[model samples]
Target: MRNDRTIKWLILLIPTLTIGLWEYIRHAFLLPYLSMELGNLLAPFIVLAVTLTLVRSLFARLEQSQQALQREKGTNAALEERERLARELHDGISQSLFLLAVKLDVLDEMKIDGPVKELATGLRETVRVMHEDVRQAIANLRLPPSPAAAAWVVPLRELLGETAEMSEAQADFSWSIPDVSLSDKEKVELHACLREALINVRKHANATKVLVVGEADGFGGFRCAVEDDGKGFSGDPLQSPGRFGLRMVRDRATAMGWNFLAERRGDWTIVELRKQGGAAS
Candidate 1:
């Protein structure tokens, strides 16, 4: 920022100072041999030379700084994204591994009269779930970083498309979002939330068509929704057995400092995520 300010000052002051000095010289000294008319005629050329020599150089330097800043920002964002993905992988595997160990310990400590078959079945299920989690994490790791060169919503479009195919639902998606509305971290969280919402729609909502829409809120904020025309299921996360996915999404929203809404609006089941203006993005 300091460099930026200095460059701007140079851009403005170089021309103004040059013209002022030239005028003073033209009147006070050049007026004798360099006539008033000749000095007047040469003023434009002097200014042009100063602009080309000093101001133009400053402008190029300023542009280079801007490009450097952009590159730095992209690098930082990429690092942050990698860190977040690593955390996701670690957390998922650690929790499942810990649970698996606990189950194993219980089985090992069981008595002859214990429910050994039941415990075995539970252990098998846990292992299956852990396997799936590992597979998913590996797949996520293989995905390239968010394409900065393309629209950020490109991945979301593919996700929704897959949801549509898997659920046999016609999905309609649209967005009108300005750039910088979501930071990379916020985008990851939003993607997870939307993925969870779509999973709920596919597994629970018996809908024929789904609408996913995102838009700038006209206040430097953004909102997106996944709405399905199906039998919307609703319950308190604490009391609902099938609402675990929504619970996970809601937890993620809270973590991201965003708003989460899941409700039945008339005939549509709506799952919406929103973040207000002045967010880190």
Candidate 2:
């Protein structure tokens, strides 16, 4: 922006200054040695020389510098977005495959006749669900970035609905956040964290129902979560086989100075993201 302004100002000022200085010098002191007709011809050539050697070159260098800066910015943005997608893949798709593999290995080890057919059918369903997830992720990643997008609740609601549809689970989202509660980037980041949580629920939770809730208070603090009535493990979910996605969600929240937790609350497995402090709601 600064460079653009400088270029504009120079484009207007340089020509006028050059012409004025040349005319003044020619008329003021050269009148004795030079005739009016000769001075007139030399005046144009002098201005042309200054323009070609100085103004043109200066503008060319400035434009080249500007172009370089733009290219650098574009490269940085692309790299950042690529990293974001890589994280998503590691957390979502990779973790899903890991769980699928674990389940299959367990099923293979079991020689029971009755449950073998059931386990095989379940594994097939899991594969089909994963295929749907990958397709949905590709469609989402292809969308252009939009900072001035709709309110946070819109996409989150749609995502929860999709998760429910794919998993054949009951899903509901309750949002109490006003439009002013979160900035654009905050909304985007929180949405992504919640997405990973939902993916975990869909792939590994074996949930029959899902509930997502988001709310903000007057103190600029907010809370959000993806909760499911899924099977509970004996230890911390962070130490479980599907920990990769949860850890990614935790890292994202921590980087934003927010709190994240993946744990079982009674019979409910809740993955929560929160920020406890800021300006008055």
Counting clashing residue pairs in each candidate, in order, gives 0, 3
User: Each prediction's TM-score against the native?
Assistant: 0.56, 0.56
User: Which 10-residue window in model 2 sums to the lowest lDDT?
Assistant: 143-152
lDDT of 1 by residue, 52-168 (tens): 888888889999999999988987887778667767777777577767867777776666445776767677665664565455555665565655743556766776777688678
lDDT of predicted model 2: 0.78
Q: For candidate 2, write residues 1-281 as lDDT tens digits.
A: 78777876886688789879877887899889899899888877887888788788778978888898997798679667966895787678867776786777777677766767786877767676666666666656555444453544566788888778867889988888766768867877888898888888777777879999888866788889999998845687777775798889988888888888877889898888888868321
- Predict model 1's lDDT versus the native: 0.77
Top lDDT model: 2
What is the TM-score (0 to 1) of candidate 2? Answer: 0.56
